[model samples]
Target: MIQRAETEHSKELGCAKHLLLAIGSANVIGVSLPASLSSHAGPGAGQGRSVFFSDGVSRIRLTLDENSPVLIENSGETAVLTFDGPGGLISVEGFVEKTGCHCPKQAYITINEGCIFSCRYCNVPNLDKHIKTPDEIASLISDAVRRENVECISLTSGVVGTMQEEDERLFAILERVRPFGLPIGVSVYPTPGLSQRLFELGVSEVKFNLETATGKLFAEMCPSLDRDVLCNALKEAVGIFGKNRVYTNIILGLGESKAEMKQCITHCLENGVIPIIRPLTPSAQLSHFSRPLAEDILSISEFLQSELLRFGLDPSASKTMCAKCMGCDLTPMTDLHLGEVTP
Candidate 1:
């Protein structure tokens, strides 16, 4: 039987990781919440203007020409954030740099940042949003994959009007990228038939983020969403997308107990949906909450390993984004069983 307790090393690793994300490494660089980029939307981002950061093993290319919801600084060890313009530092909490990767294979793009409903923890609304034409999206994919390292595509978005509306917009961009023959992974709000629609569109993997786990917390954190509607959508999605192909997100440190989180994992496994677990990183918009206890996240991650493995899901084997990418989080259960790093 799997013990639900965290190991000493596991606890230390978890705490260190959480501290990095909960409060970005102040020793390396100091940063703050960035202002709006609307002031810098002068022209299209040009070539060779991208800034690069690395964790010694993997590297990333970022176009920091505009203001971002995240403020970044180099921890001088792992990853660093660089902006093309002035005032790169202000003040923000829970800003952990993404884990660096060598010759990255996944390219990430956002459809639009506009949202019809607002989740109190969401920071998307802090920035101006815009829609991209199919051709423009195609160009992004085209340029993104120019390196041999990039092998797949991942797209995320805020709801424009409704799930149906966002689906239509996503489909348009997928059509443009389909010709490239690269697998596409998408994370978005759950809507009726949205999973079926994506499967029909030939998407490789689908992620419907539930955000938080418990019904009471769901209602409290996401006031505009209906609990029943979201649950039904997950079930329906699994039925159509099949096991492992469907994924949902569970944000830790939102006042959810370990038992509540486990219940969610079991539910996802039972319904053929994979749980993409992540710890909460407090942003300027949601800075009121505290970072999760490192031991708690480690214990939870350790606990989920058996359940996830019992369900025949492996993080390293994941073909879609997050789990497979392992860039943002340090201890995604998907990456290993109990803080065991795999090469």
Candidate 2:
């Protein structure tokens, strides 16, 4: 009976893995929440109000759309997700998770909602702009710590002024929250001395998003940003932050080829930086792009996991940010759960 239960658990996890990718690879899903249910928008722009759904094994952050073919209905302790299948409707059972901050057990805060640069795919600049003061940020973190299951504190921001100015603002906010003594992770545009400064601030980890896979695509997409600066920060971040502590976000379905994805993943692994495989969310500004298929997401995730293992970096070791959250992207060692890692 124990052997049979273990086999059933394995099969359940396999199903959950596929379902998570399926839900994440899509731009929207069908879910109806009671009007009384609280709504929370992610820190970034262009993101719709989303909810975290977790099965017993894995979790996914899904953007709700009433018209989507994939529908989720709340059922007492869990929820039932029904989607159109090749044969008919298929349903999976899970529960909609409640989060204290942007995600569960972590207060993911955004210092500023405005950006000066125009990254074609991002919708932050187009959204209404707001910069939270250090006191306000501290209050938010303090309240989450006092009232919720807050474990880590994370901060990301749009470049409202200059990168230096943003860094200064981030430092001010960091000073306010340092009293809480929680592991803090930050994601921002890399500026000179940013990595070393953040390390000295007692930050546990840091993320510098690459966004795209290659220089050519990066040049075309993020023309205002310097690829070299970002790369240099990533390298320095790995060295200062140590292995499994530095990360980068590489969004799929931005017209990047599989080869490009593999090459970028290899580059990050070579540098001891873990790459986050995020699916592109199609927006009005980026409607030309398509969301990657579930299979494509899985393929890249497998490749990333193999490379991370090869480089002696482990995503499961990450303490803060997306790697620890495992909400938005298919994290390598954490999500795939392929085999045991050698410490």
RMSD of 1: 9.8
Tell me the number of clashing residue pairs for each predicted model: 7, 0
TM-score of model 1 relative to the true fold? 0.72
lDDT of 2 by residue, 1-343 (tens): 0011111122233345544455542222334443212222232245556666666666677766555555566764677665544334455577776665677788888788767888888777776788999999988888778877798999988888876788899998888889998899999888878889998888999999898999998998898999889999999998898978999988888898999999999998898888988887776368676677878888888898888778888877777878888877776655677874675
- What's every prediction's RMSD, in angstroms? 9.8, 5.2
Off by over 4 Å in 1: 1-19, 25-104, 330-343
State which candidate has the highest TM-score.
2
lDDT string, candidate 1, 156-256, tens digits:
77766666677788889888888888777888776777778787877888777787879888988888878677678878876776656777778887888
| Candidate 2, backbone clash total | 0
Assess each prediction's global lDDT (C-alpha) against the native. Answer: 0.58, 0.74
Clashing pairs in 1: 32-90, 32-91, 33-91, 58-101, 58-102, 59-101, 315-334
